[model samples]
Target: MIFRQIKLPPMLGYLLIGMAIGPHALGVIPSSEEASHLAEFGVVFLMFTLGLEFNLAKLSAMRHIVLGLGLAQVLSMLALVGSAALLLGLSWQVGLALGAAMAMSSTAMVSKLLTDRNELQTPHGQNAFGILLFQDLAVVPFLIMIPVLGQPAEQLTSSLGFAALKIIVVLTLLLWLGQKLMRPWFNLVARQHSSELFMLNILLITLGIAWLTELAGLSLALGAFLAGMLIAETEYRYQVEDDIRPFRDLLLGLFFVIVGMNLNFAILLDQWPLICVLVLILGPIKVMIITALARLFGNSAGAAWRTGFALGQGGEFAFVLLALAAGEQIIPPAINQSTVAAIIVSMLITPFLIQHSDKLVLRLASSEWMNLATNLHQIAVRSMANTGHVILCGYGRSGQSLGRILHSEHINFFALDLDPEKVREAGAAGESVVYGDAAKREVLIAAGLMRARALIVTYAETHSAMKILEMVHQIRPELPVIVRTQDDSDIDLLKNAGAAEVVAEIMEGSLMLASHTMMLLGVPLNKVVRRIREVREARYQLIRGFYRGTHEESDESDRQQPRLHSVQLTQNAHAIGYQIGELGLNELHIEVRSIRRKNQPSIQPDEQFQLQNGDVIVLLGVPENLAAAEMLLLQGNR
Candidate 1:
């Protein structure tokens, strides 16, 4: 129960457990060569999952920012860091390698933090994810360059061209094959109904593609990620994901722990002063540069700052690249050790840094340049709030279509979506939108719910929707509340909590489906449409009448009519061998609507309907009569 109450993440607990058992502490798992191999698998799985979320269409839509801004940031950072390294007496090849390592940001850490904070679907989050996507893709080129650049007599020009050509060919082939072949194979596996076999195939496909990419002289991570993206395009993607998650999580935890183990605390302590200076200077400088680049590409100032804070820490891939360099004698082992130590410290502090980033930005605003960016952000927010608007929570298919209709009608409304890319796209299309969890009071306040005309929730998660409704009631009970659900069970709860309307999506869908089937069966289209319209209108009127306390007459009518009650048998019930129709239920003022046998579907009861163990019977009668019937039915047991 205490575990249920704590707002802290489960990941934090995992990280703490890892730290406690790490080599620097209890040393339960010693940092060894075998441990390193396990850690590498963690990275592989992490990249694979990341690939699953990559959308080629969406990426194409944001090509200018993702490709252009991403290229600018990566190239500039590489140049700046590499030039500095060269001046510090490092060879040019080593300098370039170090620069490439530093230029990349940690996708795993930043994406997780954003998601945990429910900021992953925000405009800033989209921009950050786009940039990270590019960085992940860039690993391929960087991997190829390392071997050529780290050579003793570096013929850089020839190697660079060859590497570029090779990457283009491999990426093109992967994309083509992934689109043409992978989706069909996944569908075939799904049809088999053997979940274990499907999952096995998923793992094999991911790792096999990754191995192929590595054999082709590209990064294994790039291949794994690409394979994931291919699999994501299929309808069975979520099923595959559900199966692979346990493996992905366990391996990724090992990766982080191994990262911690690689830190040389003694060397870190010896160079603490230098390391502190570098972290303080480089971290903010890199973030500022990237953030500025984001702003230049048309992101809001707040979004830019968010992207900066998210990507401020060094990425895990940097360690991989640095290790490669050290192995090839391109960089001194001490340099690699120091860089890894710095990265670990930076990552550890990042969560705190982000949590308090707003205050830090205000302090930094004293600078003239920073103040300019801050002012621009204020303008952006003002521009977004040209008029008071309704706030719509949840942008799934129904919500999205409703939003589109709202847009066509020229309504001023803001949307809050859980999916980062959707929110980003909405913002890009000039809609007033924010990414956030609607259940949180702070998130609601941030979205300006109190000032909005209405709150519409279009998702089917009952608890969160109810929570939002309660919060809205507490703040402004008069505000109109509209919600959509998939079941009738929550109707009373939502109504009591003050929702003005609760449209059942499943019921509506089923009704529509029935109408279409009727039309296909040769019913006149006009008659079919009229019947559907009448049914829908009647439902609306019924609900409205019920809420207005005018449904007492209807309730009396229902009481006058016979009612139904159900009794499901438990394993220990004494009536297992009894036959329902043979028990003379008619004499007891009861009727069976249906009976279900073990491992079989429910069917209408016949005279021969046997009530074996675990059978559930549906009976109909008036309340008092039903109670008497039940008592008589259980008389023999008592």
Candidate 2:
């Protein structure tokens, strides 16, 4: 909770909490074999989740990055680090183990950070994710190999060969037969109409396969991962994922805590100098290697640098691999302690490194500034002649709907989206959309922030929305920005951040559902509409008094709906100098919504309020009544 409040990874907090309570520190929690074994289930569930997410189509699409860039990164890191270990006089086994551990980067941390920064769709972010995916697959082989390496040198080759054959046969059987039986078995369970039964069946499949692999002398996590992969092919994958998340997270937290308990403060302090050296070299070396590989794979210099910075840190799997290596006696206790300490330090600094990487790239990579300029230039070109146009921060479903409406009303709009494919396809269809990050001030400015009448953030992510709002308010304070949210939870926060209106999708959706349900239930349409209006007025202050649009006039039903119409009084208008009471708009069934004067906010005017020339009186009524009221205001006859 504390980490979440501070926006840091909860895994880091779990480790710290474990350190404070473990035997090495305050000793509130004693070291026990049973606890360690229990925590290992966390890794099992973690692998299971990883397997569930392994979609064949997704892998095929990213095969180049995952196979090319990801494969090269792991191999290069292993070779380079292994060579370094050999020069330092470590045994071959130790070198291999160390290389494997360092080759892995924290998938959990990097993924969460990318999502929070809304960069997962960017080139660097996608490349980082691909690398992380391959690293995760790489861990399984190391899990199998590290243990086999611990055998006597004479028995090692035979043991490795036997292990390999066993793994092959087991995996082939599970995958080939599991896919055939999984769907039918799940169907049988689901037909029972019992969630508990479905859940139990899933658990049974996960653990039963895990136990089988253990019996075959393989890692429990490997079997669990296989189980997940089989289930991924089934229609029940999403449901199983949702059901298994709680177990995965709890066990994963416990796993990290146990890893942390292994940290000896005394060992760390004694070997602080060595640990510091490892920390300093580890991240920089990985960054250089991955950066070069990314560039070689055709990523732009800036994106390549970002990918490198993102995956430079040691990962959760490093702890798992390190613990396994320690257990197998591949690494000495002192060396293991120092290496673990270094990894922890590297993880601690990773967030800071990634946060500043863009700035660093701009300073180091001359091409980055050019990239930014080219991007902004495209946006500026699209928006150059568009005055009072809507600037859409995202061009997803919601933005597309809004864009169509705006276009129909003859209102110009320019959209900025990070997805290249979305921009390309939409642009090919003649949309004024450009590929750019809306969170950046320059992108917003290039989209005509100063000239835009309003800005609408269609995406529901609060963090990115907040950043966009910050930049928008900085560039154009008076421009009305409508922010979309999932619920009312962040309405106040967004409004406080200068959003003119925060539209909660949940609220709007519920209102729509209720309205439809009421009409279908034979409730009067007028009553249903009034109910929806009341609910909306209660929730959205700025949205009160529905403003009729020109496009809506073609819909006959819209003519019957209560609408707001603004009448501008000219110098010769009959009602210009008359009082509100004398206008007799009430006889026409019109309600004065507000009075808008030049350079002033709209205000509600009471009866007997005198109207002056140039005052725009907003009247709310049905179309016929509103039209009659307008005639009465202008010509003094209805």
Top lDDT: which candidate number?
Answer: 2
Q: What lDDT would each prediction earn against the true structure?
A: 0.70, 0.87
The local lDDT score (0 to 100) that residue 186 gets in candidate 2 is 94
TM-score of 2: 0.87
Quote model 1's TM-score: 0.60
Count clashing residue pairs per candidate.
1, 1
Best by TM-score: 2
Candidate 2 C-alpha lDDT tens digits along 357-430:
87899997899999999988988988899998989989999999999999998889999888999999999999
Q: How accurate is candidate 2 locally (lDDT)?
A: 0.87
lDDT of 1 by residue, 352-471 (tens): 777776566555544534644553444336335644566788877877788888888677776777676777797798766655667767567666665676789987766667778778
Where does candidate 1 clash, by residue pair? 121-420
